[model samples]
Target: MIFMYMSHLECPKCGATYDPHKLTQLCACGSPLLVRYDLDKVKANFKKSDLIGA
Candidate 1:
């Protein structure tokens, strides 16, 4: 299952947003996109140790 906190992709420079589950190219403003997450929700569900082997 997908993580509940994984929200969407966003362009940091232009503030453009895109669907996280889909493949997306660069934003129209020509900036690289980044994955956005709900940090509070993620923190509630995951532990730092979960990343040990990843």
Candidate 2:
């Protein structure tokens, strides 16, 4: 089974789009990809106490 909550992917170098639900690696052109979050939704559904401190 795969966890599929991720919404979008943005390239660190060229800012390209990819499927967030799929397994991915650094782009062939040489850059990292970052996962984006819906902050409002996350905040509405979760609280500060729900997370562990570093």
- Worst lDDT run of 10 residues, candidate 2, spans 1-10
**Per-structure clash totals for the candidates:** 0, 0
Clashing pairs in 2: none
lDDT per residue, candidate 2, 1-54, as tens digits?
Answer: 113335677787888877876767676677888886656656644565366431
lDDT of 1 at 2: 43
TM-score of each: 0.63, 0.56
Give model 1's clash tally: 0
Alpha carbon lDDT of each predicted model: 0.80, 0.66
User: Model 1, 1-54: lDDT tens per residue?
Assistant: 345677889999989999877867688899989888888777755665477646
Top candidate (lDDT): 1
> Residue 22 in candidate 1 has what lDDT?
80
TM-score of 1: 0.63
lDDT at position 53, candidate 1: 42
